[model samples]
Target: MDKESNRDEGQAGPVLTRRGFLGVAAAATAATAGFAAGARAATPGKDAKGDGGVLEVAIIGAGLAGLTAARDLQRSGCDSFIVLEARNRVGGRTLNHDLGKGYFTEAGGQWIGPGQTAIADLARELGVGTFPNLWQGKMSMVSGGACARIESKGGFDTDPRLTHELEEMAKLVPSGAPWKSPRAAEFDAMSLGEWLAKKNIPPEEQIGWATGIALSGGTAPARLSLLHWLSMINSADNIYERLEAVKEGAQETRISGGSQILSIKMAQALGDKVRLNWPVLRIENWQDGPVAIHTPNGVIRARNVIVALSPPLCNQITFDPPLPPRRREMQRRWPSFAPARKTAHVYKKAFWRDKGLNGWIFQPKGPVLWAYDNSPEDASFGVINAFVNVSALPSDPKAAEVELSRIYAQALGDEALHPVAYYDHDWGKADRWTLTCISPMPPGFLTTYGEALHPPAGRLIWSGTETADIWAGYMDGAVRSGHKAALNALHAMNERRA
Candidate 1:
């Protein structure tokens, strides 16, 4: 049997199936071979073909934003458009890959917040249901080399005084929305760490907030600017109902099948309008005519383009005539490191769930900074994902496993079961165009480029979770950007017709 077959039969841990890995690695080769086979013309040249002036639209990056743009175009009676995806798959950051045993887990962007209209709307249209995350079991805590479990009805107050101090700090800051505060700009410029220090919070309390938010949203607290956090407060300002929803005991939902199902269905619905293996290299725009997009295959023409990839990847495409000076500068100021790597380990079984552990362990100094049960509902399989703080894990996989094991033991109790397997992707090292997540403005976003980031400059329309009026860094934001951009494009098209 081949290695791929062997892996399916018994082998596990980190190694990709031969066919799966080879298929992704050899995408260029396959594309070239397919082109050579006369599958379709290798080059796309501008032609005044199609009856009634074809309004060709080219979208770069096929993640949530890109896919949404295509769907909206279809809804708007658009006939000609192309979705250029650089990755092997269409989901972009929300990919779900199989890990043997008929199970799969998210490669990136796992959670969906309630009331996020974009993703929620897509899910409703596609019939995908969501549940709240289950973190209700007895949780574990590790601090200053000591560990303990907070039983049911017990809060994570390893140090009562420290917890009180942190609570005080939370109280000092205006709850809900701080954006309109006269001190908003000044507050945004401050770092969470600096704020904590200024408030005289204890070290344990500081680390709790820092590490908690880092693992919670996959960002380090110190790295996030005060404005970013306040922006979150501002966005959630009217979210008092969110607490009520949580009080009802909810489970964070995954697509009944998986997020990939949504992507597959979206693509299937688009048919030929969506082009796979089309890697866009540059976008050249003319003031009067359609915009020209150059990919490795050739040049594509579009009436307008929607860029949905992360900020880092959007920077890769050189906009001919260059993006407006302010937009270019905003791109420079945007943070790239916020979307760091988030990893998980899948198990043959979810033994911890039965042990009254919610699979949440906070280890300040381990490769497995945090882990959760991202398993599908069958209860037959469970995946344990960890986010490694270190740039590179120890060369030895066993050592890495041991480090995770030790951390989980202390945090989840010494009896925490050993994981059957592990999975992670280095999103932090993803290229200039693609990183793990969107970086938030450090303290000076509001004072520097806050409002400027959202304004449209010429043909360019910015949409991502960060650019969303609500749920800025979540899947909802991505959906909102795409929906809004589509509306904006449709209005422009209508005006031209009039």
Candidate 2:
């Protein structure tokens, strides 16, 4: 959603009953009417003062999902809600790195592209400007320890034969109901490596594809599921080019003030209703109303809740009566691999562009898998970003810097050796609230347990990029999910009264 990779499988939920489904359909009208009337009070439990002492809603995680829900509720004249967040800041994956000189770059999620209209619309509404990604010039291509310059003609460097084959496979895996595909079980059973191995692509080409997979999915092909990968492709219009290419593809554009600003703006509108550092430790009484959310700041009771956090982070909160077996299993078996780190090498000028290079660098054997020109639009300063998984690299920052410097110099000559300033955020190391950068679904994880990704686990509704129906791992998908979760919470809560 934020990046072209469509990274993260951060969603999990359970199926609801027939009555619940009917209730959702029936309560939609009441929820809308309630919102239309004046409901703004900004306190969670005050709804119960006169009407049974039950708060209307309690949302967790002040990221895009939670913040979007809160903002929409505010707009709907519903203030009987509170957004509880564990971290001191907003924007889950979208973070900005101040690079000085009136230029700031995104350190986390911050990209918009073809068909990613949700985020684009949100940015436009929030008064955030957007710039197309610089994919115009010659890019440095590294393969088997050698580097060469290659130009982009709006086509991927991948083989047409390989790309076409994969694209055909993608058509079968619909974005909304990937599990319903006739070959779902077959694709779900195999890892990307096994599937590629069957295709018998040459080793060098395989290396290229592998790097793309890692950049696209935020994990290596060997660890990702063929089904999940195909589904992501489907989300991009069943075209492999839409998922991987720059022109008219997912890596098309970026927000001007960094993607995080969208959430920041949303939170600003909601005011203090968005509470930071209020990490929910436990959720009690979900089987009935007045669900108690225990946090370090104490407990807050609400009639409905939306856990708009990553599926794994959902596991961190102790559920009083425990989630359903399938939902629990979803969190238990979900793996957090390749926690990501992004580094922006800020320079005095765009030296790479002077050399006719667009600042796109792809390293096959890398701690920095994909490096590109992420310079500010003003071109006032140059910023080269390394979107990488530093799991196997050095732990120390200086040591890591030295290694990265060496790698950049090898690709961009001596000018790349030093930076005016280096801004990096290792979500892997720095943030406890964001445990995994993305969830690359492994073999059999979806089909065997895909049904758990929708429906509410009692009053605890689940949402995030990963749970999105269309662009499940992208920022657009995250926004779409937020809207959906808000509607679900509204509908379900109103259903109780009926």
Candidate 3:
């Protein structure tokens, strides 16, 4: 077992400011206390029920969305609820690769920036701190076998005029419902790649745009919907840089103690109300009150069921009476191809910083899509995290590590070859539950099946990061969806009593 610690000390580099230091200190203290208190709480039990042998609510998938909903229910003085997770772990998408000795590098959704108040507020409530992503020095752009150092404060060097055009187009699309946009048909008719091709963007400059969209949307621009991309930009306040860049962007700040800790802390507080390894195989009688949830363990009845899993994952659970045709078709067609692969290469120290490099590497023709310094706030050890092209890299972990190390050595110094440890997490192969890391909406997807995403199917209320109105496909969106789902459940329950 890896040892975990929340302490943040011995700051290095210009990564953390004075305010960041204080924030880290306070968060560490709060998190330490929270963990201790949670440990003292009652141990998690098998099941939970109300006086009527049925729960008021049953939340499926113990990810950020479901866990947040469970926490909200507890806060609202409601105990007739239980959280059922398919995996043995509580966190759904958010995971941490424990590096032992109180340090951890995030393996999944870890960043929260300006306008992402939902997750920011949740982190504060959970006593978690945050720090800015390291992007202080020159970034390396590697093509073919040559490497060029470029000055990029925001970690990207895309054309300013093109970004402005994208931002303008994004304003017409609503973050919640891209299909409702005035230019929905026109925008949805074309892919991002097509739009860029019309502009005759230079091949060199196109790499930046492609890398950004691929990292966020989980596919090449050729397959990504322009309307969906615009909606994502709208989520970042109709600012292309805010959506793509690290400085004042969606990938700006990282949560303390890893993003998964928020879900962990919430599950701890919920205790026995949270059930792990309880995959809901079927949901019966969902069209009426008192729905029956059939799991591997047993049948659990609930008045309201929060289907907090992603749209594609919902296809796994059999709806006894069948779901609405539109909703059913939406789930069946939901894009789940973006199961991204992330790797972390740990070193004795961040030697790249001394070479006037921020540890940011962008390879256009290589397996490394984007690699950046993911070292801890204190900089106790150097951790270079990257989103890699899975198909290009070796299948074996050790061989992949060696290939990546060689790539890093070319960009950074030869010191990259002497990494102490390497951690690789392929979301596609990690588990059956997570079909995709991010939902890369293809052209025409939103216009065809988006309306059915938010609406409730009988007693089952759809809730997940993808269901969020503002920051869908983000951690903030997951929390926002959770809040909405919990409120919906509470309102339905109250209406029944009335």
Number of the top TM-score candidate: 3
TM value for model 3: 0.92
- Per-residue lDDT tens digits for candidate 2, residues 1-498, read 011111122210000000000011123223222221222333344432324555688899887888887777777767678888776667777665544333456767666678888888887787667777888988777655588888865445678887788889988998867888899999999998887878878766775687678777777788899999999989988878778766787877867656666776787667657776678899999977578988877678888898898888888989989999998898888767656877767677888888888887777666777788888777876778877547645756666666777777777878887776765567766667877766789999989778887878777888888888888877888898899888888787678769
Colliding pairs, model 2: 1-474, 1-475, 5-216, 8-438, 8-439, 9-439, 13-452, 48-53, 48-54
For model 1, the superposed segments whose C-alpha errors exceed 4 Å read 1-54, 143-146, 152-182, 216-218, 238-251, 395-399, 409-418, 430-432
- Best first by lDDT, ranked: 3, 2, 1
What's the lDDT for residue 204 in model 1?
64
Report the poorest 10 consecutive residues by lDDT, candidate 3.
10-19
Alpha carbon lDDT at 402, candidate 1: 63
Residue by residue across 57-106, what tens digits does model 3's lDDT show?
99998889999999999999999988888776766777766565556677
Which has the higher TM-score value, candidate number 2 or candidate number 3? 3
Candidate 3 lDDT score at position 346? 86
Which prediction has the highest lDDT against the true structure? Answer: 3
TM-score per model over all chains: 0.80, 0.88, 0.92
Candidate 3 off by > 4 Å: 1-47
